[model samples]
Target chain A: MEKSTNIIDCTIRDGGLVNNWDFSVEFVQDLYEGLSAAGVEYMEIGYKNSARLLNATEPNPWRFLDDHFLKEIIPEKKFTKLSALVDIGRVDPNDVLPREESVLDMIRVACYIREVDKGLELVQMFHDLGYETSLNIMALSSVPEHQLIEAFDMVKKSPVDVVYIVDSFGSLDPKDIEHQVNKFKDMLPNKQLGIHTHNNMQLAFANTLTAMRNGVTFLDSSVYGMGRAAGNCNTELLVSYIQKASYEMKPVLGVIEKHMLEMREKWEWGYIIPYMISGVLNEHPRVAMAYRASDERDNFVDFYEKVTSPESTIAPASK
Target chain B: MEKSTNIIDCTIRDGGLVNNWDFSVEFVQDLYEGLSAAGVEYMEIGYKNSARLLNATEPNPWRFLDDHFLKEIIPEKKFTKLSALVDIGRVDPNDVLPREESVLDMIRVACYIREVDKGLELVQMFHDLGYETSLNIMALSSVPEHQLIEAFDMVKKSPVDVVYIVDSFGSLDPKDIEHQVNKFKDMLPNKQLGIHTHNNMQLAFANTLTAMRNGVTFLDSSVYGMGRAAGNCNTELLVSYIQKASYEMKPVLGVIEKHMLEMREKWEWGYIIPYMISGVLNEHPRVAMAYRASDERDNFVDFYEKVTSPESTIAPASK
Candidate 1:
């Protein structure tokens, strides 16, 4: 069994995609406090992308992750640390300030398999500025073996301390996680390995445990399985399942009880028919998402035909 | 991969344990017609146990599953056959008529590992009375290896055609299921294997799939994962995930649309903190069930401590 590592919950950041960053400041504040008490290592406030590029008209807290706004939301640092995420072309380097001046402790960079070079650029900038950094390779299930091998060669020299195996499609089983963990160990043996999983095929918890047992250091999860599509692994599940005293189960449950229940009611994520079908077919969940948005999503035959139709081919990627 | 065989949906029968057999005849009839259209092989309408013994006070229509009442529920047999469950000492053999005269086709018997002989008694009677019978050995998780070995010696010679590897506590993993399947195959090579899994640990679907890939022929599920505690495997998920042409995705979806949508609103099941804690502790879900019934049930820390208390020990087995 792998020793207990830090848990970094990205419910707000990843789950925001489901509702277009519609979470209120109060919700975020409550979540942060609960996560702090729960002994969570990090609570990802939201994405640090510039709103101008995404053209979002909504209150862009998740899009910008302003330093002033974050300070106001989390007035005091408790047991939990703070982190923010950025995409390759969506972020501005100038937006991040010194670690002490800002509430953020870490800045994570998420990019496609092809964008590793560009993603390393952000990792270098963050590392230079004294912020702990990680480079997350997204959609790992679709990445070719050679591409990952080449990307790891470049990533090994970068300043990032953590490299993640993202199961964006929720299609991989425990064996897949084991293979990916082994590959990470062989390629970037010096850097810590992280795992992010979705529950489309109900493999998130198992796959996460598998990676952890195989020496992965970072585990990503959310409360009540709230994230994009089938949602990330449940934070509460991990906290209680792990045999570590430092990982507090109370704070994660507090978030679930105080916020995530209502959030689940408002948004459509987690296991639904369309998501499960997309997962089994190893396709994107777009058709399932569209069907779920409609009144007829529960009509399995109609939903199956619509998704498997000759005219429809592209599956919905994770947000 | 093993060829897919019959899928027996016991949403009402197995799920009734969650709510104590409170389903109306109309709901059962709707499920029967719906499963038939979806090409489900069997519909387990309800248990045939005597309510007097269990002291169950719920309405008796779908509770006891009367053969005369079963005829009225589905005037004509369709693509889906009918099945009912009976527990040791809970059923009277007189209630079950021959399959030719009754609407029920299969009579499944549930028993603890110690009661295999008694359970086989009912199986022999049901088989003699001309009904396809199965012996579901409940809670294989906690049963000692020697007990199972002794039980299988008698089970191999019984009149039962199907012997199920039941994960009543939902605490087993895929590896556990693989070991159990091998043990059952070695013991009862002449009989077919069935799988009845609970989702206390969120591995029910995966375990079922693992069993199928190994050699199990019968798979049990419910609509939208509605069953006792963490619930059974989702019927919709299994139908969509498997490659069985006999399973038409449409009818299952219709059942979800008409019944489960509103049903989900009324009851809470699926992956939750309390259930996950029980699975992690390798314990039964009774503590989780108790928490869910209490005001502090959603409190993860308190739930964890209660289930892991020194006095909690191994939960006594109950149907």
Candidate 2:
């Protein structure tokens, strides 16, 4: 399993949602070194979304990653390769450099089920640019069967290196993950499969292992589960459990002890009541995240009532 | 699954290991009303272990639950039944009252694999006393195959109502749990199965679901995952996910908001790094628990090195 498995650390990429890409260059540099030493396969630095489209007056190095800037931060490539995620319509084709010229070895395109065609267009461009590519279809639990069939029609023929089953809502259990993995394997027989999970039900690590056991290659995780609400799987758990002789847990622990322990205090992530409620209902965490920021965060009974009420927009979980 | 399923919330019993049985009578009363309203099947109030044998000078209401004290705290019985857990040889047989005369509906006996016979003896006595009984085999992960076979031989003849797979070290994933459930089902063909999990590696909920999927009926959990070292599976998660038409998430949430939020701040639990490391290594968390109390609690890199080093006793996980 370790031979086929690839851990893609997404601390700065997904964790940016919690703290607005506020990571220091020193911290990012230390993380890169630590992950490399820990034998992590790839590190998703951040999004490569266009700065102009977002109307950013100030520089956000991580959100709008530049090839030249990335090279400076991670001057020399080590054991771990670098990657960046890009959303459909947010990335400008002109901005992407050839793989030989840029520090990034792969570029993942993330989108909803309806945007598979748009996502593949980016995948094709990235593939042709000599970089490894993956198309991560987000909010997978909510995608209708017909939409997946339509999406798979394009996905199977796309030049993407991997197709990711992204549990954006953190709603899935191991059984659900197995069903989706088998579906992906059947639909995209020629491509490798990846897993991106959230820990709302504390199943991120379990679900990731399920995917790996089912032959998925890429596993997305974060240091101390530092991502959006409920967070991603802990990279340390994966590293320790994978049973790869080459993998080391100490380096991953090193960076966490040095930086993440303090960052956790400043920015909230990991499992919370609202996030768990959202996941149980199979809805996006936006409402829960909003509630967490407000003064009524700890009032879990009210939050449960608000979300599960008939008048509320949150649809019941499909099961 | 919910039709046959019985949720046994162990917040006071298992959680007592973390707080030294320091819970107030008012808090216990609130928990009883809340769980009853939530339609939970049973609540394991605390230990039925004897104060006479342990020489307890102070009144440890929950730890050494007197039927008189329980009657005073609960007053009137609601929808939820009451259970108490006792260790083999630790309980004073004279202290237990017959079911017709006592408030306790069940008495669960917890033991190591080697103590199966002793555990069953207690279970038999409890059963003859007109109480439902269970035998919980602790540390299922490290028990040798031969030990399990010998233990199961005795367990199969026991009069215990339920046989439990207890992950005392929290060292199991869903795959391991599925394998164990099949073993339990194969060996003890006539008995019902239960699952008691800890969150050392955050697989408590996932493993419980796995067991349930395999037809285990008894599910053990705690509020806010508040048990010893990384805690137990969350009762809230199971209540919400089970989709039992009668179960309500609000009452569970209500008690959590009213009591657990403040309790969590004072008493440590959930997925801390040391507990996780111990789980991944398939070892007891006593070392990690002691380290956490020390000044070097957050020095995870050192802890990882110390545990994995050849000189240490920490055993590698059995895959």
Candidate 3:
């Protein structure tokens, strides 16, 4: 087996979006301890996107992690470094403090195709501030090949350590992942490639494995398939499946047993009728999400009529 | 879109294993009512495999589906027809009454590569006896290419109405399924093709979709991902996802709301750690099943140690 692969746990980050970041501090602390024991490399605590930007009135502890709040939750840093995500234009540069004072080791920047330059600007700032940084370009399935090339050219010149292939739509197959990996390796030979996948097509786990086999380094997974739409690949799946001798499985199991099971019960994601249909039809999950959240979701006849109607294809332009 | 693809609901047959076939007559009746409302073409009510052959002492009525019990449970045929599965030799020919008198419209035969002839023998008997028969060759993943070729030659000559690509291991990817579909179509050009996949690798939904898109007519799925091992492709997912205007979503949702939610609480099968691990490693779920069954399974470290040891790989010498 190859050397231990770096696992990035995204339960609190991606999963938080499912439940509007309602995770208790106790759950977060227990998750930290469990993930650390499982030998997870990095645990993405939550998005660092400013709550003011989204205009969300919800308690924003996880939405914007503060050094004071983090120190209280986790006093000791042993295994499992902490990470936070920032979207372009959403994060306030003033919110980021000295790296030594904060509990985080990495600050990930998520952006769109046209925002690569802005994303790298944050990466550069985080790099100078003494934090491990990565630039994740979202909605990769829809991005033209040349846009990625143009983006990667700038990313190659940046000080970022990791570049991710984010299958935001969960539309990529294994072959697509391999092609992306090869493209990333050829373009930026010096930087490591990470993969973030959704299970819309039920290919998240397989796609992640394909990337690992083809030499991609970082794997993003959640526990109990708890994330947006069909969810990300399960972290418990990765730790136990990698052939390395030192790959510990208990931490992952502990995370699932303690936090994930309950979290799944409370939240509705992964393998629902709409999500599965979206995956199978190779369409986006928006329609499925709409149908699921609708009152007549269980009424198949009505659901079918609405979906097949000419108006179903022509969604309202306002949203 | 293709004049309504036929759906075979295996909730009772496959899901029965997860709950030790403890389904009450009322639950089966409700499921039948629900499946019928959802426009399911056929519902496999039970398996006719002899319990004595497996030395299973459990009172698994579905394991050995008697005609009297079948009549008692689903007395009236509704919108969907009924079917039952039988293994070669284990199924008593005398046990199967004529289709006119019986509740079952079809009787399927499942066997290994070596038992194709036996499987077809049963298929011919059932066909002559006025039952829609299907030959389901199990473990298509393990079957060598040439063996499948030879088997298909005889199968093409048989009177069976349907041929199934039984992904018993859930190991095949879409490419594999596509290749298999092309091979099946080329070999048995006259027979209708069916797909039955496990969610061991989380590809059940995708694989089924691929088959449907590539011209296979029969699609087998269950409500709420309830089936053997990691479960089958979710029927709700299929109904909601299929682009066909005739596919209804409400009956599936009703099944989920009424039965599946409660069933999920009682039985643990969906996306658990062991199942996800099996999926990521591209391995069979035997270890996961063993681990889940054991009391010490939560100790992932110990389970990892036991499975990866060199001694575990050695096959025992036998006379």
Candidate 4:
């Protein structure tokens, strides 16, 4: 059966957090080719964040994607279309060329609940510029119901083609995912829904499948789950699991064998104790990720104590 | 909420598959104490498979547990109860001491669909011996509908305290788990249901949670998912995620830190590509396990081709 599901590969974008967008041109090319051969619909090549605003001294092609650079890399595009993610205020409108002028087909705007209006503004700009647009609301687990309702009021009027429920904390189970998807569907009637998941507590694949089962169209995945903290859903798992006959697992496995296996050995990602603790506690993985970088990384009992202590429970200064 | 759920840790029993039941006495003791402090209901210590039948030269304590040895290991019983699994034709009935004489509380009988009659006979023997019993129907994904119906008809009449739906292949999703739970519940209303899951697709926790939501009581897990290929659901995840208020996660984390971390380095388990491929294909992990041990272990593309190709997929001589 042909489903409306469009897999969006986020290897270079979300996975940038692990390597600071240090993906080699060769690896990215291989990933693009593999995903295309596997019949994946779109690939979020990288962030469209501007270098001037971010004060980036580095010349990372993936961090600040240039149309000319992207065309040079993947000169001949295949079945997989291109997309790029942008954080609020990080990406300048001037940097993103109109869709027909660039290799990218979509420009996704990611934001917290408070920045929904700002996200929609970017989405509107992208939509008007002849590109598909999506507004990803991160940390849905922490957002208040009233806040979501208020955000949806603006979102419902936005020209965004897709709206995503991001499991930023990687805390949600399938039941929670079902509830969120239903809420998203109810709030955004005409819009397609997408799911972006983290693998803490090993629920990423399950949560993504739940969203798909609930009619979520755009499923976000990274090669071998190469993203931030516990990482995102595995692109290979999705390709193998999704019932759509067009989707092939062999090509995904090909890239995993040819590139990701070596990359995984060098990079730190996937299920780890601290990340699992944060997810189970429904807290952000920032503290856990920091702890993992420290010398006491394997001291999970100590880490658990430190996180669960009364002092760590206090609200941040921003609150 | 005080739910009727009982978590059974199969760390040593199922994890034995990884290292051939070579757990140190000290580690087993530590696991028992940790699980007890964490308020886990039961710990499956090891298999009761007779060494005489298997012709074992090795004195693997966990594989062939002795009543006297168990008493010496856990001299004082804590909150956590003890259990051991037995396979049909492998365990000598005479080796099982009466519940009143032995430290073990439960004796679970695991068998295939074709061997349910034999499984129940063992269950009846255990029941007569004053031991709490369970019938674990393994490789449920391979079993036909009529086979399950036949097995359940025998299972429904058995003097068993729990009946488990064992996803021996790690092939099921949450929806499949829910459906199976419903089927078990409808067929055997009087019998308590247990769930034993593997993490091949990282759906173990989600599937176990789904079963719990549907009122299945007995939940099987292993410390850091230390069972066979892809392993069982993480015991810490369940200890942290289950909101029963009393299932303390600190002790679980303590054990994982104190022992499992080093053990994980020595043995191979948890989500690997081959295990995941087998799970996605709904096949047993034996071939995948063999592939993982070969020189070309990381050659996932070759493995995918070999498994998916027409020649390798043909039935064995038995079939």
Candidate 5:
């Protein structure tokens, strides 16, 4: 039954948040081939957000994935299909090509509960362009039950193929994940479900697995857990743990050797104490991320005191 | 309801395995006081194994855990009770004093399937001496169903206070934990259950929580997860996550600041790739531990190749 599960490797896309989507061509190419060899269903190469709409000057091919550039990078499609993510307001409808004309197969839209209608609009556009689409409802842990119920009304009627339960703070445990999955299943009986987790409490892989066992088909993970702040679930962990004959652990290990280990050293991510505190408190990791960036990074006691102080509402800028 | 759940902090005892039980007097003293202030139910100070029986020459107070030395270290016992673990053949009957005459409230026997009868003998002796006792069945992942069923026949008839579901290799997931807890509950209806997990797949905390939710009572953890290989679940994580009025997070954090952080730098533990591979394969971490100690520690690809090779069975000495 688990053989039908879809593993979506997001090494370049989610990890790009840590490195500002500044990955080398060689790393991305190798990652694509490695994920293909590992029998991962999908590889999320990068964000497809329009740079012009976001008022960005730099031409990062990964951040604003050009179909032609992607084709040039890998002329032949491997076993793994390609996907890209976009925020609600950043992507221009004019910028997206039809799936038949582009290298990308899936377009995932990530948005907050308040932006569900807008997210649905983007999903409709992507579906109309003949691409598979999923809507990731970010910060599900923070959303109220009534708000989520209201949001699901729009989602149930939308063109989205899969609905994701995103533990944005990495705050949720397996019990919480089970509750959310049950609620999602009850609300969206006609749609497939997905799970996107962060590793703040070191529960990302566990939570993802919990969701999968409870019938979530799509799993989002990264190699070496390389993402923002506490990072996401490690892709290799999923490939190795999931009991599917098609999945191979060696290729995932090879990719980690060629790229992830060096990238981990260059950038700071994964389970540090500050991130753990933030995840426990169910707060956004921006404050902890800022704390880690300062000279007092190792001053965990100070960080805890400041975060838990009754008078403190230290809101750091989000990544 | 969760207030009835017992938190057994095993920082010194489990972490001692990593550093050969060579903890300083001040470190152990501070840990005891910290755990007491944190309102933890129990603190496992060290092993109570007889050094003479094991043929050891060095006099490590923590390793041997003499009652007088333990009393000297914690002259005035506070909120937390004391416990110590012993191997099946390592402890002499005369070495253990009655609970009323000693600092230790509990004596836990750790053993493999083949040694269950011997472990039960030790458990009976400790119980007769008026001490709380648990039989920690080590390496439950590797133990066959029939073997565990056979072991439980002896456990159900014994004087053990709790029966532990120990994931010695850090291999099990929450689903696996749920099944094991259900099986334990079904087999030993009269005995309380405990969980001892490792962080190889970063599921230690989640697995423990899963067991607790499924009615497991005693939770084994170490401050900052300082045990052998990938370590145990973090004590702070359990203290913070468990919604018990008696649990305090600040003192746990203080102990982590004063000792565990430095200890982490001196020793290597927690979720490294080699340990994850071993956990995934359901193999004991001794091979992974040996790989980590060698000059080719960073050669993850080579390690994977060697471990997965059909002709290879690299068995290293177990801890």
Candidate 6:
């Protein structure tokens, strides 16, 4: 096992998308304690985006992620470090507290290739605030190679501790992951690399293993694969498969038992056909997610026809 | 798109394990037509074993696969060829008809490593009957390399047209498939290779593609992945993903819509967690399948504990 290899549990942050960040605090607390016990290096509890900037009427604690609330919910910090994600335009710099005052040890900036500069700016601010930072470039499957190179140029000079290869659409196979990892290694030789994969094509765990084998240091997974459309790489699988001395599979399985199994019933996720088709076509899963929510959920052929028709662009539905 | 690559639809034969060969004649006929239209080279319609030899009282057309019944069901043969599987001792030599008198173009012999000689004897008989023969060695993941190499020496001299690498437990990943294909190639240089995969770890499609890319010719799949446990690689995925001019996705989807979707609800198959765990551990799914049948079906952690306990050997349940 690589000494620098770290597992980041993002169940609350990524899974919150499926249920509007409505997870109970008890579930969140249980997950934090479980992840710490499992010897996971980091736990991303939720997003730290500014609700006022997005003009949201409803106040969800996980969506906004107040430092005071986090401290109250998790009074004791265990071995696992805490992190949160922030979108380029959604988070306000003024709203973030310094690392010494807040429980969060890391702030991850997730952005499209076009927003790399803005994303790096946030990374610089978080770095100046005495926090570890990572820049997660979303939707690597759809990004043109030249644009990725251009983004890496800015990233290589930035204070971002890690640059992630994000398979936002769950579209990549191990072959593709290998190619991307090599590209990132070549472009950003000074920085460590991370991997965040989705299960659309049922390749999440395999792809993550491929990345790990190719020298990726940071791995992002969720408990019981609870995330967006097809979910993420399973944390239990990662813990059990990775031959690290510190990692334990029992704690990961414990958290999954305590929360994710119930969440699975209420939320429709994992390797459904629609998500798979979207993945094979190398498209975002938002379209497939919408189709699954519609009345014709079981009508796979209809969904296939709609996505592959000559006139159909099958764009992501508006949020 | 290798010219030698062929798709074999095994819905009826493999899926019969789940539904006790109870498929309606109409469904079988439609599947035959759909597979033909989709340009699948062969379809394994049913088993060719003699029920009397196995001491069975009740007779089912599919389980017995009478030539007269097959002729009635598929009076007009289309582009696709027909095949049937038989166990080593379960099939009586006198029960088989010559190719001139039967609708089946191929007779596949499925057996364990210890039954190689017996299986080869059946293959020789089928070859003398003027039918294409394939030796399907089941449970290859559990077979030792030395045993497989020894079996292949006898198989190399036999008249079998294709030898299959069967992932009976759905336990293999693409990397494992690649290694197995190379080993098979090294051992049996003259015989064409086939791949039969289960979806226990949701790697069926990916593993099949890996084998195909590494020069395996015959690919086995089921409509909507309707087989035992987690089922087989979906025929629809293979047809749509394999970029051949003869392959058409709509026909495969049509059959799935007409028959498989309804079959899915009544009989559970595909990526359930217990099956996935079995696949990950490289264990036969009979244990997981038994767990699914018990009242504690949804208790994944309990199932995991039972299977992985130090005292639990988890041998397949006796039929």
Ranking 1 against 5 by lDDT, winner: 5
lDDT of 6: 0.88
Per-residue accuracy of model 3 over A137-219 as CA lDDT, tens digit each: 88787788899889888999999999998988787777788898998899999998899999975778878887888888889
The full ranking of all candidates by TM-score, starting with the best, is 4, 2, 5, 6, 1, 3
How do all models score by TM-score?
0.88, 0.97, 0.76, 0.98, 0.96, 0.94
Model 1 error, position A70 (Å): 3.0
List the candidates ranked by lDDT, beginning with the highest.
2, 4, 5, 6, 1, 3
Q: Which residue pairs in candidate 5 have backbone atoms (N, alpha carbon, C) closer than 3 angstroms, thus clashing?
A: none
Which residue pairs in model 6 clash with each other? none
Stretches of candidate 4 above 4 Å error? A313-319, B313-319
Scored against the true structure, residue B28 in model 5 reaches a CA lDDT of 85
lDDT (10s digit) by residue, model 4, range B1-319: 2288899999999999999988888999899999999989999999999999999987888989899999898999999999999999999999999999999999999998999999999999999999999999999988889989988888888789999999998999999999999999999999999999999998999999999999899999999999999999989999898888779999998999999889989999998999999899888888888888889899888888888887875322221
True C-alpha contacts between chains kept, each model in order: 0.58, 0.98, 0.30, 0.98, 0.74, 0.26
**Residue range A155-208, candidate 1, lDDT tens digits:** 989989899999877888777899999989998889998999989988888888
lDDT of each: 0.83, 0.92, 0.81, 0.91, 0.90, 0.88
Give, for candidate 3 chain A, the lowest lDDT window spanning 10 residues: A310-319
Query: Candidate 5: lDDT over CA atoms?
Result: 0.90
Better of 1 and 4 by lDDT: 4
Q: What is the lDDT of residue B72 in candidate 4?
A: 90
* RMSD of each predicted structure: 3.5, 2.2, 5.6, 1.5, 2.0, 2.4
Q: Model 1, stretches more than 4 Å misplaced? A: A24-26, A55-59, A98-102, A182-191, A290-301, A312-319, B24-26, B51-59, B186-190, B272-319
The CAPRI classification for model 3 reads as acceptable
* lDDT by residue for model 2 (B1-319), tens: 6688899999999999999989998889999999999989999999999998888898888999999888887889999999999988789999999999999999999999888888988999999999999999998898999999999998888889999999999999998999999999999999999999999998999999999999999999998899999999999998999978878888999999999999988989989999999998888888889889999999998888888888865444332
Best by lDDT: 2
Point to the candidate with the largest TM-score.
4
Docking class of 5: medium
